[model samples]
Target: MDIIGFLKSQFLCHLFISYVFIGTGLIINLIQLFTLPLWPLNKQLYRKINCRLAYCVSSQLVMLLEWWSGTDCTLYTDLTNYSKYGKENAIVILNHNFEIDFLCGWNFCERFGLLGSSKVLAKKELSYVPVIGWMWYFLEIVFCKRKWEEDRKTVVQGLQNLRDYPEHFWFLIHCEGTRFTEKKHEISMQVAEAKGLPKLKYHLLPRTKGFAVTVQSLRNVSKKFYTEGRRSMSAVYDSTLNFRNNENPTLLGVLNGKKYHADLYVRRIPLEEIPEDDQECAQWLHKLYQEKDSFQEEYYKTGTYPGTAIVPARRPWTLLNWLFWASLLSYPLCKGLANMISSGSYLTLTVFALLMVIVSVGVRRMIGVTEIDRGSTYGNNENKKKQP
Candidate 1:
């Protein structure tokens, strides 16, 4: 390996990266905390401010995937839809397959200038996690408990509040609700068979109630969200992403300077086409997942999706943001290191070593959140029987 690549593999370099992320992230979180009062004064202005603040924390991960790992995200979309990507509001539907799938999506968000205001329907458990999760609270990210009875009321209320959102944003949803594993797939297919639905090879049966409710909440709003002539959400960006060479990408692999080629296929279906009734909407979502499976299967066979490939350019914002934080934090970090070394006590050294171990475990735990083996068992036979 070359000098830069070798350095990327070093624990010292990893420590520097983690230190910068946590340090800058906590500072951003503090800033977000100050914005809480602004919400009561001017909600729109507060959201705008939080959007930019959230960008600082999220774009660091984008930098790691795009700049450090040199991953390229190729957009397989029509030119017309591509023109409308960052200019309008929409609901984004994505498959939860690989660990780095969300990173790939964020890279697109950065490329198309949607990084700051982008949002997602994430699990409620994530709301309690530090840094990113704290950042999400300020971003107006919708969190669900994965229990329909408990979530139905609150989820609708949460989404309805976005009707008057100032800026254009893509509210992303992982319709499958959890990362795909072979066991989950098997169970999902069993549910499909029990329900008399067609078996899907590349995906799990989509949890439809969430998608149905989201569509219902956002549809046919008589009130105009943007008075300055900006549009409210009017379409669905049905996206399917796959990595070239069948590579199972990971956050750890990206951190270690591995490169990947990601191809994303997005279809801009008008919101009007989706059925309004809950049961019909469920059918529509299942059909959509079936189509997504076909696209994945086709890509595996032909090495491409169903449209012309348009390579999205990497934005410099993520890189620039990282550099700003690194430069600003370096002097204080170096000073602390020097002071610790000057003390030169065995206890201090032992404490430092223990801190390193803690940091290592913390990172692994964070990454474990996306691991298939460590994923939720929300799709088991018992849960399947409870499916509506």
Candidate 2:
């Protein structure tokens, strides 16, 4: 492996990267705070500026994935619809199975020029996940409690806030609500049986409440993008992604201590036809999962999905964007701080450090609190094991 890949694989490197990403993210967020006074004057301009700032910070990881790991990403899509990807606002429905699916989606957004404003309806716990989570806060990404009753209103409010956003964006939603596991799949299937819906072999039962609410909330305001529907928009929607097979020790994986295949599947559907009724939407989502399950089965059996094409991953301007901000912002901030400390502003420095520590701790605690532990069950083994 190359030196960058080697460095990425080391445990210390992991920590270092985490720190760099988080620290840089915090600094950028702070800069964004400096723009609060501008919100009243030109909300659109302020938002656009924030998107550029976000691009700078987030591109570091994208660079890591694209260059350091040397992983390959292949897109499968019809060429007709490639143009419309980042030109308008849209909702992205994705299956939640892999740890890095969000990263892949972000990569695609970057390719289509939507990286800066890309959003997701993520579990609230992800909001505390250091760099990425911290970055999402300023981007106005929606977070959900995953409890339908409590989340319904809050999530809708969050989505509504994006209606007037000046920039185009891709709002990702993992209707499944959690990463897939064998046990979770079984439990989801039981929920399916209880609801008299078809069981999915590849995906867990999506918490329809989230998908339903997302569509209902954003339908009037945002266009819906399905993996299959991108062609209709004249935007080439790529459906395949190359992931480092964590199960197999690629040189990169061995170094990085990651153990899961970076499997990705994407399709595009248009926004106009999304069902309005929650129940119908739920059934449609379940059926889609069943179809996806069948696709996975075929893929495993044949070592390729049924699709006929391979589309190369497109590298975006995210790296240059990162470099631009790092050069422009980091030096000025450092020099300013040095001057402040030299001028007897030690107390100010101390207070800033203390505030950083407090915010870090608070964010960490919030993450810990929001995570759902599915292992514990309230019933007997057989019944408990069947529910998640």
Candidate 3:
């Protein structure tokens, strides 16, 4: 193995990378706080600054996925429609089946120049995560508790906050709400049977409340304040993702330098086609998911999406950004370790070791997001539990 490849596989190296990511992320979080005042004065300028700051931290993981792991993300679409990506605002509905699916989503965001400003409908618990979650707070990422009563207001407010956002971004909504599993699928199928809907072979019954609320709320933005001669939500990007070689990519796999092939098929649907009423919108979302299920089945059976032939070129910016962070952080870290060792103080070494242990535990907890067995049972019942 090459030197970097060896480092990618080591837990100690992951710990060091996590240290730099979290440490620098915290500093950026503080800077984000200071920018709060700038928002009222110059909203666009404040947003632009935060977008770049968010890029600094987000690109680190993008590097791990693209550069370190060398994962290939193929975009399947036509040239005419594919050109619209990253050029305008859109709502992205995606399947939550793989642990690193969100990472793949981020990879696409990076390739299309939207990594710095992309948003998601993340669970409320993720807001407490060290680096990524903390950064999301400043980005105003929409967080839901999954309870219709509570999340309704939060989702509306969050989407409303983005109405005047300066940069173009792709807002991701994992309508399934949680990762897929057999038990969840069985439960969702029961719900489908109860509702007289078609059985889904590969996906869970989507939590319609989130999608309904998001579409309804963003619809208001479109009607009220259009930007750049277009509605705030100009299009909906229905993205279906699958892994090649039946590989289930995980955060640990990426840390260990496991290369996986990701094929994402995105279809652009106009926003006006979405139903405006809550009930009608909920039905529309359900239908969209059913179509997504068919796509997944087709992918498994034929290993390709229907009529999708476009795969965008991956960019080197993510790798360059990662190397910048590594170069900037590695020297100080090595110097600190050397000083601690030369001091001959057993206490310093002990404290350092203890900190490593704590951070390692934290990283494991972070990795829990990508573990299928460790996933929550949100959609396993006829009535979905509110995501915590």
Candidate 4:
């Protein structure tokens, strides 16, 4: 193994990287806060700058996935449609089966040059997390409390504002609504059977309301949601992602330099083809997920997505971006530690070490949230009201 790669895999190196990520991220958040006044001066310009700023912090994790851990991301799709990926806005509906799936999605966005500006329909709690969450606030990422009654107006207005987004973005939706687990899947399948819907072998029952809200009215809910002049999504990218058979990669696994292969199968459907009625739209999503389940089954059998694989070369910029941050931040950290040690201040060193331990704990907790096995059980409750 390469010495540097081995060094990066070490626990101390991971700690340093985490420190730099959180520290620089907090600084970036401050800079983002200062830009709030500029929004009134030139909203488009403010947004454009925030996109790049967000990219600076977000891409660190992307680099960790793509470069540090050396995860391979393969895109499976027609060669003809490949040219359009980063050029237009898209709604990406992906299976929620893995802990690091969102990072994988970010990797794709990074490859296509959209990491900074990409959006997601994330849980409301994420909007308050330290670095990543605060950055999403500036990126116009929509957050939902998972209660449609409370989220409908907020979600609609957020979607409406995307009509004037300054850059091309891919809005991601984990339509299964929660990550997959055997227990959750069992409950989800029960709901599927209860509703007389087809059982999904590899995924949870999709919460239809998010997709339903996108295309049409949520009957008996918010009829006004399908507004005049509401911006249409450019297209729907039905994305099915899977790790190589027998490999289940986690965020912790990636940080530990466990390389894994990811295959993403994408099928783009035009906006006009999706039905405008809520019920029809729900049906469409259900059928799409069923097809996705079949793809997963075939993948486990064949070890690849069902198409010609188009794996993009990992770009130097992600590595360069990460190195830039490390160089910019590490010198002061090392120098301060050296000074403290040389001065023989045991108290200062002890306090600093304790602080580092605290930061590490926080980072570990952040990683914990991304693990699907430990993920929030949003859609598994049998008694909870079903979404449209």
Top candidate, metric TM-score? 1
Q: Residues 1-388, candidate 2: write the lDDT tens digits.
A: 6675565666555443444555678778788779778888987788889898888787776666565554455555445544556776666666555545556677667767788888877668768766667777767888877566888888889987776777777777666766666777787677778878887877877667777777776665324533323212111122433343323323234226333334455566666666788888877777777777776676666555544344445564755654555565557456756776777677777765764566555544433432333322312344765569
TM-score per prediction, in order, is 0.95, 0.74, 0.93, 0.93
CA RMSD of each candidate after superposition? 2.2, 6.8, 2.9, 4.1
Q: Which is better, 1 or 3, measured by lDDT?
A: 1
The lDDT for every candidate, in the order shown, is 0.86, 0.63, 0.83, 0.83
- Best candidate according to lDDT: 1
Higher-lDDT candidate of 2 and 4: 4
Residue-level lDDT for 301 in candidate 2:
69
Task: Kindly list the per-residue Cα lDDT of model 4 for residues 75-185, writing each as its tens digit.
Answer: 999888788899877888888888889899998898899888898888888889878899989878888898899999899888767766677888888888778888888
- Per residue, candidate 1 scores C-alpha lDDT tens digits across 176-227 of 9888999899888878998999999989899898999998887756645445
Question: Candidate 3 — which residues are off by over 4 angstroms?
Answer: 1-4, 220-231, 379-388
Q: Write the per-residue lDDT of candidate 3 for residues 278-357, one digit (tens) a residue.
A: 78888888888889988988898989987656667778887787677778878977887998989979898997888888
> Candidate 4, residue 153: CA error in Å?
0.7
True lDDT of residue 366, candidate 4: 69
